[model samples]
Target chain A: MPLSAAAPRRPQAGNRAYLFITPFLVCFVLLFLLPLAYAGYLSLFKDQLVGGTVFVGLDNYLRAVQDARLLDGVLRVALFFLIQVPIMLLVALAVALAVDSGLLRLANMFRLGVFIPYAVPSVVAALMWGYLYGPDFGPLTQLGERLGFAAPRLLGDSWMLASLGNIVTWEFAGYNMIILFSALRTVPVERYEAAAVDGAGPWRIAWHIKIPALRPALLLCLIFSVIGSFQLFAEPNLIQRLAPTVIDSSYTPNLYAYSLAFTSQQVNYAAAVSFLLGFVILVVSYAVLLLTTRRPRR
Target chain B: MTTTIERPRSRRRTAAGSHVARRPRSERRSNLLTLGMGALLVYFLFPLFWLVIAATKNTGDLFSTFGLWLGEDFSLFSNIQATFTHNHGEYARWMANTLVYAVVSAVGAASLATFAGYGFARYTFRGRGPLLGLILGTIMVPTTALAIPTYLLFSKVDLVNTPWAIILPSLVSPFGLFLMWVYARDAVSDSVLEAARIDGAGELTIFFKVTLRSLVPGFVTVLLFTLVATWNNYFLPLIMLNDPSYYPITVGLSSWSAQAVGGNGSNAELLASVVTGSLLSIIPLIAAFLLLQRYWQSGLSAGAVKE
Candidate 1:
């Protein structure tokens, strides 16, 4: 049904198409490809004190493989991905379904209220959450005191990760809900009618029809969540000030790479670490695509 | 059969008119659902509510009073004043810089994505599949992974600490291109272009006059996305720019917060400024989102659900 397939092909049209795409291609090369290549090239060498910069091929990567700090950050984010992504997606799915069901009062208000956080910048979200997690002056802590109970120090070493996860979830759940809700809107009303004819109620229709139609949108959200989790930086980096003891420079891989290059002057090593992290992200996303797509659909 | 159907339909009409009394069970369920949504709304809006309350308090009351309640003094105007005048009006400069970057990058990226997407959708060129695939594949690459390397590359060309360093990278959005590609395919019909061709309009002319009009929704979607990305960008600008003048609101507010947290006693006053500045920075974006909600939502569904 595309125009390209329907219209007769012209000889010059193919060549002329390049004219339109060239600007984007030039930028893509300069910004995306060139930086990736340079990062790869930078990853191969090590900056040494005695000999200045030396080409130590694969050594930086090998060291990264054994580097406990880097690997710990990777594992931490993997754990974060496992815990935070599901809760956020589930919440998003619940909110989207509620809005779509038309059973709740003031659905539009709820949708917009939830989505307001997405418009807030991550830096500001982190800052706001940091203040709220303040042990001494935070409203939640003050409320706990009024209620005659000791609130857990949210920014403490044990609770820091969960607090960061809450910030991320708060920022992203509404966004993911919008995506899912939009997809839900595209589902035909006839399906609901047909399901009702078959003696299905709202709960049964949602479980059977609505959810099955949401798989592609859910997968898209999952892949994005995976990428976002692996690239976690701003929240942890900003919150580090409040929980300095809990969050070191190597708290997340991206933060680790940042501190490595900027603070430690290990630019070459930082590139290697980031490249490896990128590889892990690629593999994880690929695996997600594989696992989700490989399932047999009815 | 007609009487049987009429009997049920007449009864259903009355039931619909008096549904609350007719279906008490469903009514209770709906009430429960509304209550749940209210709880979720509180969870979502509590922080923003806290922010609004926090901005009104002075530095002393900020530490002394409850975060959710108003302090004895309402310093919202003075806090806003302090935020703007801090460090010789650096916050205003950052706001201006962010506007330029976001507006320029949004316009550039949207224009480029529209052109490329139109080209991809309308033409069958050599290596089209691979080229499009390459663009899509770039989306998965973590943006943070590229920041250090992009910084390295930009520094070599003496572009670091400049607006170009931020603007150049922000202009190339693979996701925007993909969204437009999907949008253009469905939005612009072949017959329209054919009609324009017969009228002796050039390809570029047809694109500007015809294709662009239909693609406005998609273009606005990409523009808003790129606008938000550039406006909120932190990692790239943080690594690229060292000068305070070039900082976007995100980076500027971040530095102020950092100073508030870790600086000496003199900088303790910056905490109030940070909260107020954040409140100011987000207002325009949230307003834009609310105003353009119709376009972006439709554009998103068009690009995503159609695919």
Candidate 2:
């Protein structure tokens, strides 16, 4: 029988619907699925000298586990979280509370002013801050000289990591504040009024009412901050050109991966490292999301 | 209980509520806190204010003028002219490329994500939950981790230097997919779909005609979020594009800064371009937000709450 006659009379709704979604499906598979599959395949092999990259199953994963640079990069980002996330989130929470209080004049001005940094591209922000951190011609170094206090080199080994953390915190605190403030808004004025009637002071209210209500939002910021911190590349990579001694080609894992793939031209090993890193991030992020998103018991 | 209300009432009776509100012991404390916060806000905004003021001054004034203060000469218009004229209008080209990339990717991604979301929400397909979970799992892969592999893949296909390099990645936003799924689930009622079905409407018709109409707010929300994300994307293009002409504004400005630091030319010209470019770059986003302020502000809350 002819296919036109044999098929359902209604223009094949399944085919039509599938066709409607094919563009997305096709693009997703091409970009994400294919790359992921390729990464997985590459991860199972190692570069063999004579065989010219023979299949050495599990060798890459074993090497990744023992890699000193990867381990150091992981520790560095862990230290970053220990120092950065708390301070940033605390400042953001404070700002959000101040803005939400409705007591402060120029609320919108302050809000926009603070949030403006978030809109600035991180590359540009890093460059601008890099200029300011310059020991020779920068405003900070100049100001320090005028004040007669020897300002430590901000991008030096002893202080470069902290300096980078400061830049990250500065650029992102306001963005997190917007998220936190928006979350605070959903807590209802009635809850505050009720607290006030109960003789709760502002401090008491913040601790008991606001902080508790902001748990989920805080978790969200932390999760994202962790992911963002782990993916540190552009800032340190750009800054590396300025202070070669401080940041190596593999200062962070992403930069390491970049150097491996592009500069070193070791695409297969780079793919392995990328997949390994991706898996680690995936586990950590999902763990955080799962733990944060679970409902609180009544 | 009554004391809280009575306190404000008594405070209202005093002259200069602003001053009176600052006089009491408790009020004075709060005032100090507010003033401290105000100063912190200024610290946060200083860079932006520096950009604005510096944009007004020429090369000589940029150095001679006080770092934090405005200069006597206002050469903002001249600066703008120089920014456009230098490098054969590279900045303008970057602006056009950025607009095309952002608009097309944002619009394209949002539409695709919505359809995916609707499919997940309305249809009962095999392995839907696991597929959704896999999609969500992709979000956990820190984007930079995939940069190397993605670059190699694109390179293999000879798409490394093209705009498609950026556009393709932008269109596969997993967060947009997740958001649209949530929105479609809550916003589109099954009863409405059933009613449409009883009226002889097919699934495609119901989705396009009924569900999509009700999903306007969601569509706008996804569009705005994706737009901002695409506009701010730097890493992808930095890795993909080797040519300066193909550079988006973010990458283009960064390159200019690098050239300045390298002593390739007058740093002021590049700095001026950055200042003008940033101010102009934010204009469209600000305008979009202002125009859709109500919808967008609520959308942020909706997104945060749903999480």
Model 1 misses residue B229 by how many Å? 1.4
Per-candidate iRMS values, in order, are 5.1, 9.0
TM-score of chain A of each: 0.95, 0.87
Q: What is the C-alpha local distance difference test score of each model?
A: 0.88, 0.74
Q: Give model 1's DockQ, 2 decimals.
A: 0.54
lDDT of 1: 0.88
The first chain of model 1 has a TM-score of 0.95
lDDT of 1 by residue, B1-307 (tens): 1122234334533433353444466667778999998999999999999999999989899999989999999999999999999999999999999999999999999999999998988877888878888898888888888888899899888999999998999899888998898888878888888899899998999998988887888899999999988888889999999999999999999999888888466488889999999999999999999999878877777655654
RMSD to the native, candidate 2? 7.4
Give candidate 2's error at residue A8 in angstroms: 29
lDDT of 1 by residue, A128-190 (tens): 989988899888899999999998999998898899999999999999999898777767666
In model 2, the Cα lDDT at residue B165 comes to 93
Worst 10 residues of 1 chain B by lDDT: B1-10
Chain B TM-score, candidates in order: 0.91, 0.85
